[model samples]
Target: AYGFKTATYILDDGALNGLSNDAPIEKLRALEDQTFTSDLDFKAALSNALGDDKAKQYEAILVTAAAKMNSVLILCGILLFVSFYAVSIGPVMWVLFSELFPNRIRGLAISFVGLVNLTFAFLVQLVFPWQLSNLGNSLTFLLYAIFAIIGLLFIVAKVPETKGKSLEELEKLLVKST
Candidate 1:
């Protein structure tokens, strides 16, 4: 009348201590398998699965079960999303950056600015995992969305249109007197 089709967690140790239930606490033996009821009455074994790292790993458990969807579908969706994001945001940014500075310093300015942008992109990639783990997904994504809105506002107000204007005109409009 028992099966081991999968790993069923019955004993809740650190966080599981919150639940209190019991059938026969006094007569229970050490060999008895832990039951998976929300209530835990009998004293649990002193052994800890988290072990020495329990303090760090005990925060919040984020369970990600594998999706049953087709692999092709998942890959196609990701590719489409990335393609749209890049096409929508990438070229415009390069074009605007190329047009921002005056001709005299344009090459040097773009290189320096591009380096700064690359650094920030690397930082975002590095910090993203920490943000998701510490702040949770909702707040982490909200932070990025807020920054995106602020960037949009700056682009609209500060960045100029390069449609048909010559480099000289843009230099006059954007560059300031020392």
Candidate 2:
């Protein structure tokens, strides 16, 4: 969720900053044509440009870039985990709340819950960059921690167990008064 929100924010900012979407599409098409060229052609071009000693230097740069790429991959993995936790916990809490409500109000309650969740999500996307810029990484994470704590508290207080119940049983259970 965070990753998706970040991407949306970046794209929106790019549009605001006068980045033409078609420019990237055109650039990608040009890259597709170059990708079909043979490795022999690429090697010959490289050899002509770099000679021998410069080629060794280029190889060293490639190795350095490769090492940095590993660190990049690790950071991407951590971001993926954060996104998974955000999306998973939000739905789990929503489901738990829905199960606790009576059948007649469950749909309305779920819809209201969804609206609240989406509003927060939209605000998070809009304000995250500002938060990061002003508060820095530690305080940004602290805000998320506060949100998680509140959400957990709400879930513990209002959610009822649905474990080991069949679909019909759960439905009937929800219909009963708490």
Candidate 3:
């Protein structure tokens, strides 16, 4: 009953979110292709197969594996945090980029930055999967740390403060830089 309810909820939600109603059937077929056991009672059978003593040993191994995964999890958490901060930084950078240009060139400057952002985003997506696969966990983290540090430095050095400044005042600041 619970499984049926969950499946119905998922199907309805997926349809509402613009997924085709065929999604659930396709997913089920994929699971069948992967040779997953279709028995709804497999949970009970699995517990019976393991027995109590073996289950305890299995649990201990899982705990040790989870402990080793802590570093990777922490790195992932940091990445998520940094990504959130970057989202906040984006608008500020855009505003500052806009302010740095003369009125006649502001649109051009914005378009240039937008293109650069899009290019980098595309490159990041292309590279990141290979980096994770080839570099292993620690090196992948080291790479992210290096990039994060560089981003922090760029923000500090290249980004101008724009808080509470009028567009005319910002223009004066940019003009003084020339």
Best by lDDT: 3
Candidate 3 wrongly placed segments (more than 4 Å): 1-67, 71-83
How do the candidates rank by TM-score, highest first?
A: 1, 3, 2
Q: What is the lDDT of residue 109 in candidate 2?
A: 86
Q: Candidate 2: TM-score? A: 0.46
Question: For residues 84-176, could you state the per-residue lDDT of candidate 1 as single tens digits?
Answer: 668855667767777777777879988998899899999999999887655644466567768867987987887677889887877777776
Write down the RMSD of all candidates, one decimal each. Answer: 11.6, 15.8, 15.0
Best by TM-score: 1
lDDT of 1: 0.51
Q: Write the per-residue lDDT of candidate 3 for residues 1-178, one digit (tens) a residue.
A: 1121121111122222343343233322222212112122222222344554543444333222212123455656677867887787666667667777778888988999899999998998999877644553346656766887899899789767888888888888878887
Give Cα-based local distance difference scores for all models. Answer: 0.51, 0.51, 0.52
Q: Which candidate model has the greater TM-score, 1 or 3?
A: 1
lDDT of 2 by residue, 1-178 (tens): 2331222101122222343332333222222223212222333333454555543444333222212123454478577658878887745777666566567787898889889989989999999978764564445756776887797798688665787766567777656744
Per-prediction TM-score: 0.56, 0.46, 0.54
TM-score of candidate 3 relative to the true fold: 0.54
**Alpha-carbon shift of residue 153 in model 1 (angstroms):** 1.0
Q: Flag regions of model 1 displaced more than 4 Å.
A: 1-62, 66-84, 176-178
How well does candidate 1 match the true structure in TM-score terms?
A: 0.56
